[model samples]
Target: MADHRRPPPDILVIGAGLAGIACALDLSRAGLSVELLESSDGVGGRMRTDRKDGFLLDRGFQVFNTAYPQVKRRVSLRDLCLRPFTPGLLARTSTRLVRIADPIRRPGDAASLMPGRVLSARDLAALAALTTRDVLLPASILKRLPDRSTAAALTRAGISLSAAEELLRPFLSGVFLEDELETSARFFHMVWRSMARGNLCLPAAGIGAVPEQLAAGLPDGTLRLEAPVVTVTDSGVLLQDGSERPASTIVVATDGPTAACLLPGLTVPDGRTVTTYYHAADTSPLAEPTLVVDSSRAVLNTCVLTEVAPSYAPPGTALVSTSVLNDDRPGGEAVVRRRLAELYGTDTSAWTLIGAYIVEDALPAMVPPWPVSRTTRFAPDRYVCGDHRATGSVQGALASGTRAAREVLADLARQ
Candidate 1:
C-alpha cells in the first residue's frame, strides 16, 4: 500500500509542451522536486510530426526563428540540425511569379527588383524604413508604440494600399492564419524583428524535435507521458484514472481551451484555425526553399520542403507543403491541390496527397489591445502559462514558462 502522507513534489507542471518542459526544467535545476505530466502519449502538443509513406509531415507549417531569446537560452541550435529558407517570398501573380528578396539577407537577389515590379520606389523606401526601425531599434521601444491593427500600421508607415494588398497581405495572412491582418502591430513588429535578425528554419527531424529536445535535457524521472490530468486543484492535479498527485505548486501549461477546462473561470481567448496539405511528386517544382504566396489570395502559402531539407522526403521524390486558412470544407484537399497546380504552374493531379491536417486551435488571435505578456501567478502557488497567456508564438510559450518558473521560485523562497 502507498502512503498518502508522503510529501508532495515541490512543483507539478501539467502539459509536456515547451512551456511545461521549460518550467519543469527551471524548477528542477534549482534543486526542487518537479514532476511534469502530459496528457498525450508524447510531448509537443501542437508541434507534432507525422510520418506517411516515407515522408515527414508536420502537423502544420511551422518555422523556427533563431533570434527568439527564450529559444536560444533553453535549446541548443546545432543539435536540431536546422535547414534555413531563403529570406524572401515568391508572389504568384496572374501573369507571372515575382521574387522579392530582402536586401540585408540576399544582397545579390535585391538587384533584380525592378522599380514598380512589386512595389514602387517610394513604397520600397518606406518598407526599408519600417524594417530598419523594427530591426535596429530595441524591442522596448517597439513594445511602447501604440497598439493598432497591422493593416493600419502599414498605412501609417506610408506603405501604399497596392503594396499592402499585393506583397504584405498574402504573406502575413499565412503568418497570422487570417486574411484580415488584424493582428496587433506590436506583435507584428516583434515577429518581423525576429525574422530580420534570425534564420527561418526547420529541424531536420521535424518541429516535434524541439519539445523532444527540451524534454531530453530534464532530470531522470522528471517527465511522465500519457498522464491525462483532468482537474487542477489547489494541492495538485487529479488524473483521469482517479489517481491524485499532490504538489506544493501547479502550473497549467496546456493549450488555451484545455487550460480553461482544467481551471474554471479562466478565460480562453478565441483561436485561429489552419489546414496544411502535403503532396509528393517525382520532381521539384520550385528549386529553392522560398515560400510562395498567391497574390490573388487563393491559397495561404506553399513551399517545397524537400528544397530546404532533402531528408524531408525520400530520395528521387519531392515533398511540397500547402497551407490554407481552415474553412472546414468537405473537399478542401482537392481544392488545395488544384490551387497548388495553378500556383506552381505544374500538374498537381499526379502529385500524391500525402496528408492533410486541420488544426482547429492553431493559435490565439492577437488583435489590437492584446497583451504581449500576462501574469503567470494566477494564485499564490497556482499559475498558468502558454502561448495563449502571451503572444501566440513559440517564443511566447517559452517566455511564459520561464516567467512562471521564476514566479514559483520567488514564491517558494518567500515561504
Candidate 2:
C-alpha cells in the first residue's frame, strides 16, 4: 500500500486532538500538505463521548462555554444545538440549598440574591467589583495585573472567608479540579470574565461533537487513527506499527506528558485528576439545568444532564453526572449516591450507575506567573502545541495550535 511515487506530506501532526486538528486545518488551508495522526481510534483526545445503552456520556463532565474566543472562531454554535445551564450555581450549605445567581442575567433569581441570604454584604461588594472589572476590561489589562494564588487574590479583594469556603471553593474546585485555589489569579479573572460574558452550555450530540466538527474540516485522507508514534526519528517519526514517515516538519500536539516524551527537554507542568460518575434514573431529580456544589465538599459538582439536553438520554430517562476531584474514594459508589441524595434532596438508591471515568491528567496546574501563550518552536524542525503550552482550556488548545501553524509557516517560508 506504499505510494513510493508520491512525496511525503510537508507536515506531520502527531495527534488528532483539538490542537493537532486545528494545526493541520490551518496548515492545509495555507496550501500545505498535512497529515494528522491519532493514537486512539478517533479524534477528541480528552473530549471524546461514548454511547452506552442509548445514553450519551462524555468522557468527563464537560461544558462548552460560548464565551471562549477560540470556540467562537472555530465552531458553529448553531449547528451544535447548544443548551445552556443556569447562569449561576446552587451551593448545598448546612441548612439549605443557597442559590447564587446573576441578578442581571436571571432577573427572577434576584430575590434569591438578596443580602444576608447567600453572600454577605462584604462578599457581595467584593465579588461585584471583581466581576464588573473583569467583564468590562480587556484581557490585556487583566493579564497585566499582579499575579498571585487565586485564594490570595480573592482575600485581597475583600471576599469573606465564609463565602470562600461555602460558595467559591466548592464551585471552583470543580472547575480547576483542585480543592485549593492555587491556580493563577490571572487565569481565574479571565475565566470569571468568560463566565459572566458567555453561556455555559452542552451540545445536543455531546462535547465530542465539537472536535468531530473540527476534524470534519480537514481535507480527505488527512487523518489516520490508531497510528501511534513511538519516537521522533531524525527525519520524521517512527510509528508503533514499524513504519517511518518522513516530513519536513513535525508537531507534537499530544498532551503534556506525551509531548514531553516526544520532545525531550520540553517542560510539562503538573496535572490535576478528576473522576466523573454517570447515573441513570427513571425520573429527573432536578428540573432545571443548573450546577450544584456541596459545601460538605463530598462532591465537587453535579447536574442533571438530561435537564440541559434531552438528547443525552433515551426517552423518559434522566441522566445525572457528578464529578469529584479525585479517583474512586474508599467508600466508592455508595458514598457518592448518598452525597447525591443530599445535594438533590431525592433518593438516589434506585438510580443505576452508567459509567465512571477517572481522568488522571484532567488539566495542567496553572500556577502563578503561568504564560497565557508560549512559543511552539521546540527545535529547527520540531514543534509542539497543547493546553500545556498555554492556559489549560479549550481556548488555550486551539490558540496554541493556530500559533504553531503560524510559526511553522514562517519557518518554512524562510527556508
What lDDT score belongs to each candidate, Candidate 1 first? 0.88, 0.92
Would you list the clashing residue pairs of candidate 2?
A: none
Each prediction's Cα RMSD? 1.6, 1.4
For all predicted structures, in order, the TM-scores are 0.97, 0.98
Evaluate residue 186 in candidate 2 and report its C-alpha lDDT on the 0 to 100 scale. Answer: 87
Q: Tens digits of per-residue lDDT for model 2 on 102-160?
A: 89999999988788988888789899999999999999888789899999999999999
Tell me the number of clashing residue pairs for each predicted model.
0, 0
Clashes of 1: 0
Compared with the true structure, the alpha-carbon lDDT of candidate 2 equals 0.92
lDDT of 1 by residue, 1-415 (tens): 1126445677889999888988998999999998889988899889878877788889999998899999889888999999999999899865778898987778999875767866799898898899889989999888778999999999999999888988899899999989989999999999999988899999999888999999998999888889899888766788887878988689999999999898888887899999888889999999999999987766899999999988889999999999989847768888888888888889988998888888988999998887898889886688999999988889999999999999899988898
TM-score of 2: 0.98
Q: Poorest 10 consecutive residues of model 1 by lDDT? A: 1-10
Output the number of the lDDT-best candidate: 2
